[model samples]
Target: MVPKGDLAAVLASLLPAPGSGGLVGADALRCARALGVDGVAVSVTVGSGLNELLWSTPGVSTQLEDLQFTLGEGPGPEVAASGTAVSVPDLVREPVDRWPVLLPEALALGIRAVFCLPLLAGSACLGTMTLQRARPGPLEEMPLADAWIVTHALTAALVQDAGQWAAFAAAEDGSDFYRAAVHQATGMISVQAGVSLAEALIRLRAHAFRHGRPLNEVAEDVVARRVHFRHDDGDGRAPLAGGGTEGP
Candidate 1:
């Protein structure tokens, strides 16, 4: 069951329905603060090696979320790999090797602590809810539980709401029609590169990140037959037409 908190009400009251350039990340940060975190961010998987920032509290949290996406290592992936909450009371005090790239950078951001809670769909871990604090210390047991509740409720709102259940649940076009081009791009690349769906997404995201572009923009290109993954290494080097796929 989803966490029973005032978040559902808040989401209903504040979030823009479906994809009006609303809900998702903005609401995610709002709900996280309601649960008493200094900052909150949501990371959702679009494919292997691919996840997007669904929402984040303004300021440092948002920057950190972007950092995680760009660096490819952090509590985001740790929680996904471990399938459990990652509580770092004080990043400065922890071993430096633990988060080599992310740690040094996060310290520069004045983030003393973090907690990453998993967002699950049955047995599959879909994403994570990451909260941060300026002061170093572990999250109290009670708020930790609250964080879990919020994670469940938030994932429900982002993924299961309104009968939309594709990988991302919305289209980039913001139209009345739903288009899972991102999801299609993932699968299309999977077959094109002969890799698992997850690995395929990772490749796509890498290309987007290297070029300093958004994943959806890259996905749109793939869907339009402008890009294709011809080799199995997951490189976006394949150039062929009419190899795109669409979602149901």
Candidate 2:
């Protein structure tokens, strides 16, 4: 439990140093420990269609982010859209209709609880901070307060030096923030299917779902030219361009 006086200090210690600019280092793991969560992730809302992952702890944290991107559902997206924090203390008790696809998959990944906090600048939500717990329980009072403090300070820092972070993100673009192969595959599908990029992404998600495969794996196949999306192909029906079993 963080004392009132120590809260400010805690926030300062967690923030990135001036000119460090981006949130792509060990901060997420450190914050997870401090917040008593198993893992944490921060992602920026890139326009209306994409939420680019900024930094995240390895394994489940990263997988959860990718799952949300693949299915376009989850607490992170909900927080980003509504500018409100989402706390699911127990996924098993959560309504299936709320996240019909994400819930089961996340549970399969061993995530029993989750929380998403909005990074807001004025009325705009710049991004989201997601925390995952392997056990089903609500965040304790102190950790919840600390999470808000960290989120507030982080938001202020990003908003105060918006240009610097923007340049940092642009420089890292595909390599750091966005998944390179997924972005590349989306473009390929857009061209091949004569659909908008947004629609192409939908098709990609649909394909990944139909095959019961990770979106990244499917995108890698597309980028590698193992699979192709022809104009005549419907959703989840990308044919094998090189005569293969499509993808796993």
Best by lDDT: 2
Candidate 1 TM-score, true structure as reference: 0.63
lDDT of each: 0.70, 0.79
lDDT of 1 by residue, 1-248 (tens): 65456565545554446556544533655566666668887777655555766667777887787667656789998888767878899998889888787898788888999989899877778888899998888888777877777777776776555544442245435432212566688888888767787667677767665565555667888878687875634445443221333222
> Where in model 2 is the C-alpha error above 4 Å?
1-22, 166-175, 232-248
lDDT of candidate 2? 0.79
| Candidate that would win on TM-score | 2
lDDT of 2 by residue, 171-219 (tens): 7442343476888998998887778887778888788877777788888
lDDT for 13 in candidate 1 is 50
* Candidate 1, lDDT over the whole model: 0.70
Candidate 1 lDDT for residue 110: 86
